[model samples]
Target: MSSPDPAARPGHAPPLRVLILEDSRFDAELLTETLDRTYAAIETTIVQDEQAFVQALAHDRFDVILSDFELPGFSGGQALELARKAVPSVPFIFVSGVIGEDNAVELLKRGATDYVSKGRLARLPLVLERALKEAADRRTLGIAEHRLRDAHAAADRIESRRMALIELSDHIRDMDDPAAMAYMAAQMLGRQLGVDRAGYGVVDTVAETIVIERDWNAPGVHSLAGVMRFRDYGSYIEDLKHGVTVAFADAREDPRTHATAAALEAIRARAVVNMPMTEQGGLVGLLYLNHGEVRPWPSDELEFVRDVGDRLRSAIARREAQIALTAFAASLERQVEARAAELEAAKEQLRQSQKLEAVGQLTGGLAHDFNNLLAAISGSLELMRRRGPLARPGDLERYIGVAQGATQRAAALTHRLLAFSRRQTLEPRHLDLNELIHGMEDLIRRTVGPEITLDVHAAPGLWSAHVDAGQFENSLLNLCINARDAMPGGGRLVIETANLSLDAQAARAADLSPGAYVSICVRDSGVGMSEEVAQRAFDPFFTTKPLGMGTGLGLSMIYGFAKQSGGRVGIRSKVGEGTTVTIELPRSEMPAEAQATQPQGLEPAPRAPAGETVLVVDDEAALRMLIVEVMQELGYATLEAGNGAEALRWLHSGRQIDLLITDVGLPGGMNGRQVADAARTGRPQLKVLFITGYAESVVLGQGSFDRDMHVMTKPFEMHALARRVKDLIDGP
Candidate 1:
């Protein structure tokens, strides 16, 4: 304030603002004109009374104050006191004729800057110049003192916090118990930081959970001491996981906490600071400060908090390491050598046993399921054979039917296992699940049992998915049956369909790519599963049902099917809250085709036409011979090949082959696909039928080869293969 006013510069200088308290307008104008001689420009305000003078001083800033000693009701002495209170830093001068030198010196001692007598009006310029400069000096000195006080206060605060942290470090360094150290650190932080509560929480990054045992709290404040799923609070937990210090001034105002602001207020955490502690490349713990009032967290406060947190971590570790060392030293001579030897041997045996156990569990479960199916097939076949010539009328056919039924079930089991491995052959169709669910509603109700309630919530304008229809239906039925079993006393089962557009955040959470997807969610209101059960639900051979009641492969098969179809599956279950299994598949761009209805009657397969030559290729000698024999019985001339090379040789021989039948997986130099590609070079219009167990065979029917190509999985009935061959060769 002591420096010259910025507005009073050399060029284009502002007017010297002066307030005049005089009854005579003429004297005021003469006074202003007198000061204008010393200053380039002077602006004057003339007040005739005490009220006007006080209002002018309050409403404006002036460089100088000029008052007449005599006023109608107010004296210059009285005006001086008011001016000293209103603008103490501005110069006050009296330009009065009646004021004597003795009186003037007395007034000057009373804080008046200068006096200019009416008798000597020309000396006014010199008097006014000195008054303004002296006022500027006093103003400058006042500001410097104010700044010095602030700097000293800040330094004191910093030193206080630093000493507090050092003392806390010393206290925690000697404490052997981690809990005691943590609690003491929390208390010191809460008091030093002026917060309502301070605490440290143990983190479990693997489970994405946090647990608090104890914390320091102010009077009447409750502690958040227990296991917690931070996800229930808000999105800021992710920041904590990344070792970021999350600070929010107000829970209600921050976007991250807005959804649960009321819940935050309940814990007196209207504002918060979460300092994450990370170790071994993962979040290990959290040091938190909470308050009921919202306040700005400055950079210095945050840095100070981080320093304290680091010191706390080091001191806690040192104490714990000391304790460990003491315990190790006390027992060193007694058991160290023998214990070490025993531990090594036990570890090696444990590792070997673990490997054997895992292998045995998987193989044993698979063999058990397969043996059951094989027994049914082998039993039915031997019974029919033993009946031989003594067969009752219509008995052989019935026996054959039993064997066929068992064989079909065996094939289904193989497909389910393949699905669980994500290797099942798929015939993906563009399907609107709304229509599919509607069609299956009756069957699903019956399968779940008459006691269970079924509701299908098919969203309008649902996107279609490109997936294997048969696999999708099987997965759905498996889910429904599981739901039914969960609720022994029947409950509501909801099948919900919806379209979702996931962004990167949500997609990462769901372990999927960011894009549009169609989701089918099956939710059951029944006796729900625990966290442990829900986690292993997708593991093959891990089921919870009683013996002979369920094959744990159902969920795993559904999981594999979803993944193989460029999708994801997730499950959520809480005790007494029921379970929900959700499958999210990528939305298909193509239009959905209407499902074809099955006919009530059967039609026999057509025989091969004249000049229809069919080539049969397979790696299995028995399977190839069977197919060749079936072709022979159908009156089709066939060339049998044991491998891809042998089949290509026949095709390249310029023979008139009407259709080529090749197994997708073959030994020797090439597979069926390669063999077809080689032969198609000369015969581009060659009709081919691919028999595969791999869904990669989708390339033929659903993708690139949209014409003159077909596919069927292995282990098909001879009659079905016969019809397919005839249709490809003789029909369109």
Candidate 2:
């Protein structure tokens, strides 16, 4: 190392301070003079002994040290050691005559900066300059190394703090309980920051207090859980609210903590770090760290505390939201349950109202229809009575016929009412719908009239349905008649039959069991019904027909019959378009039998079997007498009873009764079917005939009858009655 040339300086610089370690004043002055000869400025301190040198080194700063190799007591090596201890960064050079190369090399190795021999007195200035330059370079290097160590230490502190914050974040994230998370955060922060106590506080602006939610204290440290109130800390809280960290090395002496000093002293806190926690730009609380000894909080530690505050705030907010959401869900569930119960109650009320409404409609329509029949009967009977003796044979016969026709119409209407009420008995029989529809083609066309075109489309191999054949045919006729009335002019009427296989989905939607079905659809192009009218089409007595023009039980009867026969009915209609009514009946697994086609016209009264005895029972004496006379006229012996008890008496008496004829609705507490069942105990094959104005469904369950049994509605012609009796007597 060599000093820069003094000649290269632009101006005079500060003097170089030098220390001369020598016992001889002459040598020291000589050394100084040698340096002054080349240098512009110099300042020197000369010491003679180790004591003098030690004092100068301790009290003064120097650039370089020069010493002699040998002295009266101390050697240059000892001087070098003393200089090394006092000013380690300063250069030490030996300028002694007694010092040889070996000793000089040893001295340099022993921490002397350099050695200049007395024999080379002219080289002293150059050597001294070099020593001074080297000393300056060494001082710069030492400062840089010290700073580097400090930087490494600071970086390590940052990394450790960052890792602690990350661990705290993870712990908070994994915890669901707000209280637990708060306590855990406090504990982790206390350990990370090496504080005696750490705690979380929640702000209560309204109360002007900060509630200490959770706290963790190290061993032998007091907890701060009960400490609260911003007023206790005077205006210090205002600073925290404005996002300033409140820190103090000594709480007892800090002006900002004067109001809270007593409280701090109680907790044995010498220093404190109070970091504000904020949410949505408003101060929510504070994160507090308390130290039992005075501690100067570094900027990094303050920043870390702030970060923990943020994490705790977020965790608390999230936990609160979760609790609120759970409560809301429970409330919603309760509300839904209450609403559903209300809906069910409302639905039941609606159903009851609809039932009452249907009953009213039924009674009104029935009254209207019966009144019309009664009017016709009453008029015809009045006419007969008026024309009694003077009336021509033709006039008398016509009036009687009119009365009979009216009575028959009234009976038919009653039967339809029973059917619509779903109380009608259905005698289910395996029948092919396609064959049945085809057979009724001519009859349907005639019923619709010549104005309407009839199209019968029966699917081949149509499935068989189990339904009462007579009731089904009557239902079909009622549908056709309705179609005819719908169309004032002319329209195409299509009768279609199809085999359907309903899958699970379709069956569930239709409220039917999944299986095969047979459908009979009656479609017509006529003035269609609107949605409202169509919806009530199946309601008894609900009709769009003009008053007195319809009984309004036409569609209703069909709907009931289909349902009673284990089936459902669907109707599709649009205003000004057309209507298609479909009856879907479960497919019968039994093979369909070929139906016997009878002559359209009624046959002449058939004769009863010879020696056949008939028992006729009726509550109405006239009807009973009439049946007895008809049976006797057909060459059968006849007995008569007004009630079931009388007939049962004859049956129990073991009388030779060939056939039992009884009214279905008897007054003596026993109906026709019960008497028949009673008589069958004695004669299991006994022949019985149920004649009634009451629907057969009432007397005979499902309208089903065994062989040798028959049912005939009241108001039937004499020929029909005789024919039924004859058929029963002569079994197929």
Candidate 3:
């Protein structure tokens, strides 16, 4: 393999640079010498370790990587991985001793070009030659892909341009005035075809008379603007008569041309291509392309000229017909403008509706969470106060006061969110709409501001609605405030009340019931909404008002409350005109609840009874321990279990347990609810208090528990759990 070829053909190839990675110095040196002797152009670089192999690759580019499968510190796979990362496109091939077929396949999958056995030094050159050819093929494929993308982009551009031209042609055909259409057509030609001059010329075929009617050119070409004679040219007329394309590479040099030397000089003509226009066999006119410098016309350019000539001829023929169509187009334009205005109004309405809807969803979710927290806090506080001052003495009254305050505030917040979500527990009663508005008149006036004029238009015999008094009052107030903000420069705000009875079809269409309802409409002469705003009007937390000024929750909560109460909400707005928000609440048949003359807060009366040995079970040590303390202070001996299995184990061992108190979420095989269920089965007399952190966890949902099973959410203070336990043990 090292000997020179006897049939060697000299100077048949360029020098091939080979990167050789081998651990053994002796074998690398031998292969280098052998390659130098065998091939006239072969430069070899040898690196043993993976680091040296990688460094060589970074410093210089290589055609192929040749490495051994095994080395002292690094293997072929490691070198191959490093080489691929450095130069992803470069090919790699392994040369190792006794590598199995499976090992070779693995190397190939990892992007090695090919593998050659160690003793086959003679095949090394052949291997390198084939690898380089494959690399070249890959490079060729990559270039072809790039060219394909460019070609596709160009084709798309051409298609788009053609569509634009078609639209322009359609617009021209719809015009009535010949002179106007001709002027517009000349402008179109100058812009689309990059022409210096565009004109309409009248031609008489038999008489060979070509008259320029109207010309579009430089500012002071009035002499050439009028009709001109072309009868002197016989061959030019013949070319037009035959529909032949006439070309003059150089007018002075073309033997078939008919212009005099003076005329040619005045025109400054170099290259000219003229396409004839014909309707049937007779010639109509000619379209001309004149270049300042001498140039050959491309076939596509001539085809374009022919197309333009045909359009010009058809335009001239329909000149009178176009004039009659202008009135119809004008009417269409007016209709379109009116429709656009209507669409704009509709869009603004939609935006306001969507904003209200978003707010409703947000308020509903927030109220759900807020309610749980309130429940825990309130229950815990009630439980703590019943235990008296015996357990924590001096601190007992202070803790009770703080817990009660927090519970009240929490309830207030949830009440607001629920009002927004339209799911608040309602104590609905028949209410006089006129009287309610009259009562809220002062508040509404203040809300709308000094700049805005408040107008109340209550209809006679206005039906009353079944609504929560506080929420109804708040909703009206929110609408008035929003109206005030919208009319910063001052506008008229109108509040009116009326009756509405939606039919079955209207009910389904509006996603409401077919029933009578009372409406409170609030209209403001503020900046009206666009269509986009109207769609999102009811979306929770969606507001156009600057951040701090609006919660974006008011309208949404109102919308939810309306729907949940078997009624609906509506909005109307125009850009310059203002917005109207109307809220409808269901009518009630029951007599109205009399308004209380005064309101009072609850004061702590007396300590309640705490009896029976209650079992408090929880996985959290702090919570379980807190419950135990609360129960013990309440004069009840408490039994505890961390999870279900532990509780079950205690029951199985015959431990006396009165009531089971378990955490809903547990680490063992069973959850708190399941544990409670199992414990109740073993101990038939067991009462349970299920404590949980998540509202939608194991202890919640439609079928998760029996109606009577007591449940409480976590993050609760010691008192809430104790009161709930006492209540279950002592009864309502």
lDDT of every predicted structure (CA atoms): 0.84, 0.81, 0.69
Most lDDT-accurate candidate: 1
Residue 410 lDDT in candidate 3? 63
Question: Which model, 2 or 3, shows the larger TM-score?
Answer: 2
Candidate 3 lDDT by residue in tens digits, 643-702: 777777776777666667777778766887777777767776677776654433356543
TM-score: which candidate is best? 1
Which 10-residue window of candidate 2 scores lowest in summed lDDT?
1-10
Q: What is candidate 2's local distance difference test score?
A: 0.81
Question: What would the TM-scores of all predictions be?
Answer: 0.51, 0.50, 0.33
RMSD to the true structure for each prediction, in A, is 35.8, 48.2, 29.0
Per-residue lDDT over 194-272 for candidate 2, one digit per residue giving the tens place of the 0 to 100 score: 8899888887665768878568999998666764777765557778777677889887789878767877767767698
Q: Look at candidate 1 and tell me the lDDT of residue 378.
A: 66
Which whole-number lDDT from 0 to 100 does residue 229 have in model 1?
74
Error of 2 at 432 (Å): 1.9
- If both were scored by lDDT, which would come out higher, candidate 1 or candidate 2? 1
